[model samples]
Target: MIPSAMSATPQSRIEIDPAVVTAAGDFVVPEPLGFGRCLAPVVFLADYQDGQWGRGRLLPYGPLGLDPAAKVLHYAQVVFEGLKAYHVGGSRPMLFRPEMNWRRMNRSAARMMMPALPRDLFMDGLLAVTACSEPYIPRASGRSLYLRPALFATQPTLDPAPSTTFTFMVVASPSEALASGPLRVVVERTGARAVAGGTGDVKVSGNYGAALHATAVAAQSGFDQPLWLDAISHRYIEELSVMNFFAVVDGALHTPELNGTILPGVTRDSILALARLEGLRVHERLMDVDELLQMIRSGRCTEAFACGTAIIVGSIGLIGEHDGRLCPLPEPEGPHAGRLRERLLGIQEGREPDPFAWTHTVAPLDTSAPDRNG
Candidate 1:
């Protein structure tokens, strides 16, 4: 849902609604927490207009009141980022490489012709939400408080141009893995998810909207996600829905190189570094989908997996096609994906050493929640 901003609110001084504070106090963590199903009771918001950002606010989460003809509704002038706050093995919450997200979000905004948020503005929203929602953040293994910060055009107009006004929001969800088990992915040969020189590489809102149809088609084909190829030739692999693709080929890790059409996923970057650090060779090139499937069939490709902010790392049990054909990985449970996933999660959850200084600790504004271990 879109977030709304009130211009009349004070400037430079963040406003925390009394109701929001009380709501955060009374909010109860949901049972059987599904990813993004139940949102934290409060949301952090800020408005950008007249070449400046307004003071942020933390208010009760609810539906937005849009002008119905907003630019985001018609032209989709929006970008968003997905990251998590972890409260495991420590009372203070940790954010894994959030500066990367901040920078990537601004890149998407620039590509979308939107204004970039000031560093303080972006971090303030994130720190505010995480600090306020400390009591509700899930503390179990593989569970985290997923934070989503989004910016969308609020200026209502029919012209095909960037909106002068925008709304920025940060929302949180205490959640579990999006897909807990090994995934079944299908190759989408017919429909193209993104075109070269388009908004494919960025976190533009329209990129995901364009993938909805193929995702549904993949679901109907008995798969969890669609493996999209390059939009130009539809031969080379690109990425999966909101995730990056990886395969272990001939005792080495292989993934598609960034070609301006594939998303530079944070998890994918982490995996590459971790794999290299663990003495595994990694290759990023223009990998062909057909060749990958053939490698799987020939037992040369041992395993395949996808990584993203939500899934972390999900093994692909089998790769399928529109036709009734399947190419199962010889080692679907991974030998590589599993190890890489463990290492990545270890770094994320603070269970292992973070030599890279990727983990960022956010001091709680109020430690009303019980001990994280309890």
Candidate 2:
């Protein structure tokens, strides 16, 4: 049986606008698309006030009205989630590990003192939006409908307390694969994305915003991404700006363990599971930057990659100083990274049997029909 959260209810309601179908038909994707290049014209929205969730409504995508003193605008009390809907080899659109994203969003909200979204409401919002936007989902291998669900405090106050009102929205973009080739990462020795005993493990907006400067500096210096170290010592490797990092050293896959300072990524967990099942040794421990550099210098660390719901598995070709002092990997496209990427994408796209039961299929919405009144 489908979980109750995914089941339709008489009391639950969603309003679909008539413009969605025409927008989907008119949406034009380029011949060779890249990630996050285009957005769908429809969005799903719902409001929470007085401790009750309002009926969700599907409408044409547009800007939102916000008070100048909104808590989210001033205090940065916002959280979000990222997952993908796959259309390859599937009769309907399927989500890859959506429950994990939902759970993570709640974790982030709780950390920020925001109200957690009920499981049913969370699932309903994603399903309703993806169903309405199904026709616009890109139909290509390594491409998908990127789902972004965000929650923000809307109370017009400057108080540090949690807001009495909140807005939850789910928007989508038809995107191609994020990383075209191997990445070149620069070790971030100075800045820290998250602090200890802070919102490091959560998917809050501030976390990404804090990492922007370092990322920008890395980009200007010609590195593809910044590999952040820990906050205190800046010695222990934590993660990338938006993804988790991993390295294959001495035939073993080594990734930074989930310390209080690291985000527990769904793709990172999935990769660990698939690696172990495929008989590759996997280790989750404190990977020190100095130690990794030594390994790279000694030629023990052959390849590295970054994993996330968006990037999937992006191979790391080199790591080092910004002045082109590159620590080149023995194999940029290592066998393990390639094999694992294929296996994970296969499960997500329904090209292979879902042994882990991770994918969830959502039915398409009929835009021509009237709203089902609650």
- Write the residue-wise lDDT of candidate 1 on 1-374 in tens digits: 11112112122356666577688878888787889998998888899899989888877888888899899999889899999988886657788888899999999999999999987788878887888888878888789999999999999889998899999999999999788547899998888878888888899988898899999989987999999998778899999988999999989999999989888999999999988888999999999998888888888998999999899999989999888798878887877788888888877887878867788777555323232112
RMSD of each: 6.2, 2.4
Candidate 2 has which clashing residue pairs, if any?
none
How do all models score by TM-score?
Answer: 0.93, 0.94
Instruction: Give residue 175's error in model 2 in angstroms.
Output: 0.3
Please write out the lDDT profile of model 2 over residues 152-189, one tens digit for every residue: 99999898888999999998888987784489899888
lDDT of model number 1: 0.85
lDDT for predicted candidate 2 compared with the true structure:
0.84
Q: Using alpha carbons, what is the TM-score of model 2?
A: 0.94
